[model samples]
Target chain A: MSAPPLLEVDHLVMNYVTEKGDVSAVEDVSFTLHQGEALGLVGESGCGKTSIAMSLLRLQAENAVFKSGEIRLNGENLLALPEDEMRRHRWKDIAMVFQGAMNAWNPVYRVGDQIREALDLHFRPRLSDAEATERISRLFEMVGLNPAMANRYPHEFSGGMRQRAVIAMALSCDPSIIIADEPTTALDVIVQDQILQELKKIQRELGMAIIYISHDIAVIAEVTDTIGIMYAGKLVELGPTVEVFARPKHPYAYLLLSSTPSVTGPRRKLAPLEGEPPNLLNPPTGCRFHPRCPFATERCSIEEPPMETIADGHRVACWNWREVPVSIAQEARP
Target chain B: MTEPLVKVDRLTKLFPVSRGMFRRPVDFIHAVDGVSFEIAPGESLGLVGESGCGKTTTGRLLVKLMEATSGQILMHDDGSMIDVAHIGSDDLRRFRRRVQMIFQDPYESMNPRRTVFDTVSEPLAVQNIGSLREREDRVAQMLQLVGLTPPNTFLFRYPHELSGGQRQRVAIARALVLDPSFVVADEPTSMLDVSIRISIMELMLELADAFDVSYLYITHDLAVARYMCDRIAVMYLGKIVELGDTEEVLSNPLHPYTRALLSAVPVPDPTYRKPPVEIKGGITKAINPPTECRFIERCPWATDVCHSTEHPPLEDKGGGHFVACHLVEKGAG
Candidate 1:
């Protein structure tokens, strides 16, 4: 009952300065993950989902500015920490399994070297070559890879194995939280499921909080304890995984849920967001989702809806969260 | 059924992989080996497999871009039979008009300098369809047909001026402008988003139905293959391991390669819970290709017979479902 929560973010905002103007990529987004918990951040492309994940570790590009936010990892404020101290926390405290795992692992290095690099970067351990090799084999075993494949380069492995190698590298440090950004997006369905299962099994055994980022809501629903839907740099909906999917109060959340092909139900003819994602440089006034939202009224166009708790622990940003209409609820799924 | 639009038999293409200085004699990758298939009038055949399985190479062979090392392609047009593979350079022009290929990445394929009008009209111009004004009209119509609104506005715009979906639409417009009876779409929608992917597929299907077009849809994604194809051929390495109706292949896959591949695809389903079979090892390099099954090295169910002997020829498992596997044959032996 007294175990500390793993990772927490409060009012995180990231803006990029372009030749055009300063644009907010993520605005005032906040979520919490307890130890061993997983949070899935889902939305369409250009919805700033990746930006939020990138901001967690100050991994955003030079142009990106963190206007305001508090990111605490096990009671330590990650954002406020010095660069040298943050570098210490990066691999040893919080590690990331990047997207396009095949390309993320260095081609020049053997799979074992890649994993060992993570250990050497942070731990600076005093161990013999034999012990270091044993530790690398252990990392491989945990991620369901053969111990012999340590000698192979990234190119020698297939898409799925390369992904497992990346996971192995991420786990080498035994970090408190693992942030995987679209780790399986480039892989096929079967391989994706394989990787997801491996991730879930490891998360369960290691008891590390995982932040999963994806544009596909269905994938997010599978691994997440809680779900957050981002739209145009805004966290428009946040709730329990099942609640947000089953009964999404926000219009954007409902749209995202219905659009995905559900294995159980009929294939819903994806009603894509009505309009193009806002130009971050010239973002729409008020509720950023209003331009594409069918339920948008004069109030929505003029005044931004503050994030409000519409249900038990479920927050939504909508002027009329109770009155919003979902067309699919009444229509036959395509 | 209406004399089948196109037929390929024993099509093979071998690329000699360089093995440094003093390489062995005539070593081949077996990019495509004795692969044969047919497309009936207006039918869609989806070719599916993982990367480097040679799905794209097979598509290229169909259009005569790369001449098959050995095989015959029987193409019927105006009630005349002509061998597509042995066609002289002179006749390739006529055959080109009847078949077109939709490339995978739209961002790179289309010329950035050309306007949408010029991109779609280039093929028509090659055929010497009509004057400049006439070709422009046709290009605009094609754009409109692909659901790009205000088609006239897109005519003067360059590729950089459009979104990914729009650029792909323009690419699709170029493919269909020739009114080809046979089209090879090589992962046309892989570069697109999920929501736009279905729309593009629906658009392609509708146009095919309207124009009696047959498609050789090549992709690695099975979910999309199931949605867009009437029949599907699952490939392993360079050879087809299974071919059958899409539904049958998805629900009752026979070949171990097909079973492993289908079992691996992770469709976005929160409730989808399947114990994944640990596919051991990695893909084998297709260098100096052997006679045995290429998948035998990694397949868990592989036996000694599968490793030394060639896989049994594609056997009919009824209802036009064909599979090539020694294990399947032994089960029904």
Candidate 2:
């Protein structure tokens, strides 16, 4: 409890040098993750969720450039840290699980060796191959993967197993934080669920902070302690998971919860959003969500609303979010 | 139901493996194996399954886009039944108008270069309909149907100019421009965002009711299937293992595969403590597959009788509920 929360971002504004010129990717985005908390960053594809994740660890692509912001890991300024100095903090302090990174391992190398390389490089630089192998087995065991199968090549394992291998690699350094972006995309639902459960168990036992980014609301709803809604390049809303799900203040938040298809809870079909996401390079003026918002007013098109605190734990950024009814969505297509 | 609009009987599509100069067929992958179903007029039936299952193949086969290796496809045309399987290429043109498909990826399915007007109007031109003026009117009408306001403003816009949900609307408008009676929507909302996905589904439902269109909705998302489908068919590796009322099949999935699939969906509740069953391996390879139950390798309840032979024929368990499994077969016997 004396230690700072795992990660914190204050007014993070990340930009990209695209052909269309510099465009904002994460504008005025801010959030925090406590020890052992799972924060779900939910949004459509290209909604800056990944960009914010990338900026957190300074792993952004060449075209991307951090405009202005403070990304602090345990009260340490991640942005101002020297590249060589940052290396010391990377992986050991915080780790990342890239989107669809199950196949990230070299196909030719045995998965055991891949995990061993991480441990040898990061921690125990003087570790012998035998010692590294033992550490790899521990990491594998920690992730609920059979330690015996670590010697098999990547192709030998199933998609779910490959993802578990990746997760095992992420936990190799015993990092306090893990950023997983669409980890279960390649696997089937059953396998996805199994992997998710394994991930949850790992989070619980190790007491590490997890940042889960996904386009699927159901997955976010299940795994996350808190949820954040992003659009274009702005964090539109943020709150406790149950609070956001129970009383979504942003129209976009309501849209995400309503549109998500749920099997057991409700007897309604998902109402598809009427339009596609706006082009990020030249996102719609005013609020980025205005063009697609059913409750868009004239002011919503002309002026962007600053994210406002609606309740003790709930926040929203929309001019006409109040216009949306509190009654749960009932427009099931007849 | 006055003889289902489209009746598929024992439809099977086999893909042959080729090799040497002779290309002697050593094996066949039964993508769709003897599947039978009916789409009643103005009714929506969901074909739910995981990827690599025969759901999409079955949908394609219904449109005659892929020729079946065996079985018959019958379409009722003005009280006269015509076997679509035997229809010639020339005659199939008219059938194509009546049966159109909304592909899974709207981005890939459409010509990104073509304007929205051109995309919607292309179908009218293909069927050799009215002159340019009349076709434009029809294109405008299609845009209005999909809820794209100021149709003329959209006329000059290309597919890239539209969003995922809008492109899907344009895709739907193209399919319905010909006033098709049957539509095969294959995961139409998978690529769109959650917010957009819901609205598009509602739009499709609206089109179905207003146009009196029957739908064979192919999707892996069970919740969407349950919401829109009057009845559902659960497919696994080229077989319909369960078929029945949407609510019954989802709430009480008799087939182990169906139950597992339903359980896998992550409900929007933090306190929900349902642990998902572990599916140990990937779908089994279907190379020169056997006549026995394909799900035996993965099924939790597999026994000697389940694997010894072709397990169970599809048995109707009252109220039109149908399941093809040895457990159901033994219980009924």
Candidate 3:
């Protein structure tokens, strides 16, 4: 617990500039990733979860601009580093398993060859042909894929297999951190479960830090050790996964958790959070969730709430966090 | 119990796969292989399965969007059952008045050029049930019923003008304008955002009661199915492996495939740990599928009995809980 964090994101703010206007995609977000820790960012669509992931890797789109704050890996600030210097850090220090990564491979190239390409680019002191083959095979095996299938093209593999290959490619560089964005969104439930278990197994074995970004809270709850809930562009809540799921402090977090339907447990009428997410281009002043929050007051619309710690490693950014129900089960009753 | 609203008997649909230089039909994909179920009046039935499992195809077949290769789709008419599977184009038009479909993607299902009024009133115009003025009133009423208040605002708007949730509401309005007795909604809210999805589902439930309509709601998410369906049918590789009351099927899954599927669903409780899924690999191509068990390739409990015999027949174990598995004995869990 005394070790310094592996990655520190200090008050990160990002925007997408367009002719229409600037979209405030990420607003004053701050978090840290310790070595071997698994954290999940859960939110609805367009809540800037992906924006944060892209910011971590400096892979934001051409129009994306970082307004302020820093992304520090170890003691070095990634934002201040030169483009060439940053390029060297990519994959070598931090790799990403992109959203909808099942189709990440080029159709024409063999799966093994595509993974080898990553090794050829980032893995220095160059591996010999035999050594590279051994490493690629090992990578495939590590991801629960048959190493023999690596010679097959992407088109030949199933959706689950392709996803495994994508994970293998991400780990080929042996990065200390892996940022997975909706890694299993397209696969079936069974396949998704298998892939998630495989990712957890790989993370545990390699002792690599992982940042999982997903819209599905259920998937996040199962895999992540810690959870961060994003609303509009802000991280509204950060806590241990069990603590957050058991007692969500932020109203947005509480409503989102209650709205999700579960296969197990008593079937309760899911209370849908009313209204759509706010437009980032002209988001509501003060609390971004104020417009849709049932507990919002005039003061809430005028003053933004700062993240406040209420328990060990549990923080909530809402003026009415105390008023928010302690548990979803109590609210479900009439 | 009241007479069922619709009964699907041994419904099957096969798409031929062509290969070789001459492009000959060498094989057939058994999309819906001898599937059967019933929808009660004012009841909702959920058909859930993984992609390419023919849940969508079954929905399309029920609404007569696609012709079935074989089987009977019987609908209760004024006094007797009518075989809708082979209804001629003339009778098909009349049958269409009683049944309507809501597609998965509201964004793509609606034509961009058509206004909301045009889309919702088309059914009334096609059925010739009301005059032009009456059709306009009916469309407005349907829009209000689907929770799109101030219907005048959305009446003339094109598809592109509405948000995703509003578009789906418009789609619902269009489907319900004719007051169809039965509806086949194929993954209606799957495309919407998570928060928006629940509202749409609740709206559908409210409309079902208001209109007194039955629905064959097809989806892959069991949680959504559990919410919307009174009874559930689990499909796999063109077969219904399990069918029962939604609570019964989910609480006590009998088939190995169903058990695996139920176990794989990630519950939202971080403290809850599901048993490990016992299946292996993903759904295989159904082209010229073997006559044996459809789930044999992945079922962990598959034995020689599963391979030697023909595909297991769906039989009620107890209290209308049906399963199609060789190992699951009668009267057993």
Candidate 4:
């Protein structure tokens, strides 16, 4: 636990400029991931979980403006890097497996050829066709896919196999950090389970850091070591997955957990949070969640709460963290 | 025993599949192959399966949205059995009011150009029910019933103006405007966020209780099915492999497919982790599949006889719990 972190993002703020106005997609978010660690960014849609992932690799859209922040990978500040330098760092230093990545491949091209193209484009002086093919084969095998199926088009592969191929392509450059954004969101339960297990296994084998982003709480809990709960472009809570899920310090975190129905354990009424997510265009004053939070008081509506460490590696940004009841006694902590 | 409101007896639907350069009809996909189930008045039956399992097709069949290849869909009304599958076009119009459908994607279901008032009132207009003022009153009542408060305010808003959850509620209002006896909902909450999805589900349950309506809820998620259904039917490759009480099917899954499905769902809790049941091979083509089990290719317990024989019949395992597996009947699986 004393080793230096592999990736550290501090006070990151990213805004999207539209004709209407400027929308703060990600605001003052901070987190760190150690080597071989898996951190999950869990939240609802428009919560800026995807914005945080995009900012890591500098993949935001044209209108996105980075007002302030520092993203460091292995002591190198990524934000300060030149465009060409950052482009070089992509895929080789930090690779991303995008959402619905199975369909991201060119339907007409062979899976093997597509992966080899990534290697030849990213690395200078280029790997030979034969060398790239060999590398792709090894990557495929590592992702629990047969190297023989490399010549087949994406249409021939099943949903799970196509996802595996996507993962294999991400690993083709041997990146130290992998950022997966909802890799299993569209898949069936069985296929999703297999893909998550394989991803965890590959992360362990390669000793690579992973930033897993997903909207599903259960899916995040399955593979993530640390879980960061985001709401309205802010990290509401960050802690070990077990501690955060079992005993959530933030009220938003607690409400989100209770809202999701569980497959295991006894059944109970889902405690749905009241009202819609706060509008990012005109977000509520003070705490972003104060409008929907049941425990919001006068202070909660006037002043934003800073992230405070309540326990080892557990941080929550709530003015009244102590007032957040431990009503979730049913789920035993790991 | 009282007569069930809706009963499906071996309902089947087939679509011809064409391939190769000839573009000839090579085979037919058994989209809904001999699916049979019953829903009593005010009871909710969940039909759950993965994509391409024909769960949505089954829902479409119930409302006669698509013509079934064969089999009986009987609707018991005032002590008379009306065969829904064989009904005429004139009678079908009347039958539509009794059986309504709620589609999955609210974004596509409603026209963006039309206001909420037009969308919800179309069904009444088609049925030629009441005057203009009466229809408006009815639509207002339905909107309020579905929890769209201050219905007048939302009646003029287009679908594009509403959030995902609001659009779904609008769809629900449209479906329930006719006050149907049986409703077929196909993944109505799947498109909404988790927090909003729960609220929509709760609202659905509340409306069902108030209206005394029976629901044929279709979804690919087991957790949502368990929360919404009284009984669950596990489908695979266009056939119901297992059916039983929601608790029984989830806690004590008899079929291997159901067991694998339960274990596959990532439970939110970290302490309770179950190793996923490994099923070899992917789902086979439903077109011209072997007469044997449709799940044979992916089933771990498949044997030589399983490949040669026809798919097993739904055998009652007591308490109305049924399973279709050759090995389970032989006490080996």
lDDT of 3 by residue, A164-264 (tens): 99999999999999999999999999999999999999999999999999999999999999999999999999999999999998998998888898898
Better of 1 and 4 by DockQ: 4
For model 1 chain A, the run of ten residues with the poorest summed lDDT? A261-270
lDDT by residue for model 2 over A1-334, one digit each (tens)?
A: 3566778898898889988787778888988888998999988878999988888788888888777789988788899999987887778888999888997889999999888777877885567878778888888888778899898999988778889999999998989999999988777787888889889999999988999999888899889989998888899999998888887888888877776766776576454565567777787889988998999989989998998888876789998778876844756544
Per-residue lDDT of B284 in model 2: 66
Q: Which of the numbered candidates is closest to the native, going by highest lDDT?
A: 3
Segments in model 3 whose C-alpha atoms lie over 4 Å from true places: A330-334, B21-23
lDDT of 1 by residue, A1-334 (tens): 2566778788888889888898888888887788888888877677788887777777888899888988988878888988888888887778888877568777898989877767877776555678789999998898888899999988878888888988988888888889899998877665777788889999999988898998766678778888888888899999888777668889877766555543233433545554457778888998998887888899998998999987786999999777655434534423
TM-score of 4: 0.97
Residue lDDT tens for model 2, B1-333: 568998989899989888666878988888888888887899899999887888898999888888899999898777877798899878788888888999999889988788998888988898899999999998998899899888998888988877778888899999899999899999998887777777788888889989999999998888888777899999888989899889888877788888888888888766677756644556765677778887887888888888887846777876778888887743331
Output the lDDT of residue B106, model 3.
Answer: 90
Q: Which portions of model 2 miss their true places by more than 4 Å?
A: A1-3, A269-312, A318-327, A330-334, B19-23, B329-333
Better of 1 and 2 by TM-score: 2
Error of 2 at B182 (Å): 1.2
Best-performing candidate as measured by TM-score: 3
The candidate, 1 or 4, that scores higher on TM-score is 4
